[model samples]
Target: MIAQDIVIRPIITEKSMQDITKKKYVFEVAKKATKIDVARAVEELFKGAKVQKVNTVHVRGRLKRQGRFEGYTRSWKKAYVQLTADSKPIEFFEGMM
Candidate 1:
């Protein structure tokens, strides 16, 4: 997959923003994507940045109930990307302020 198709978007919340400041970043990736895919995607999106490490998790959706109906939400994939020390950390929401 191309870089554009790989990284859907950077997940930058208060939690992740703090991480970015600390040099660690997290993202919500496609459920079907693997660690290798995530690394490639992150590298591509970050423009020549090298990924030091990649951690992926399979998130099971929680169940919700409305009235008498009960159903589970869709599961997703999460990736924690650690950039090399020499590489500039990813900046998604940091520039907003």
Candidate 2:
């Protein structure tokens, strides 16, 4: 898959925001994406951002209910990308902080 297809989108949340200071960014990756794919994708997508390591997690769908109807959310893969100490921070997330 292409780099754009591997890295889906950034996961912006209270917890994820806090990790930015540590040069760690969270992203919702493709279900089949591996750690190597994520690291390459991040580096390619964000110029000047050199990835040091990548961690991945599989989040299972959660059950939800509304009145008598109930369903589970779609399962997805999450990637934690750590940048090299000397690498510049991703500009996309800079304005968010």
Model 2, span 1-97: residue lDDT tens: 9999999899999999999999999999999988998999898999999999999999999999999999999999999999999999998899999
Q: Report how far residue 81 has shifted in candidate 1, in Å.
A: 0.3
Off by over 4 Å in 2: none
How many residue-pair clashes does candidate 1 contain? 0
- Which tens-of-lDDT digit does each residue in 2-95 have in candidate 1? 6566556677677777677556778788777778888898887777568989888788999999999999998877788888888875545447
List the candidates' TM-scores in order: 0.82, 0.97
Superposition-based RMSD of candidate 2 using all C-alpha atoms, in angstroms: 0.6
Off by over 4 Å in 1: none
Indicate the residue-level lDDT of 17 in model 2: 95
Query: Against the hidden true structure, what lDDT does model 1 obtain?
Result: 0.76
Clashing pairs in 1: none
The TM-score between candidate 2 and the true structure equals 0.97
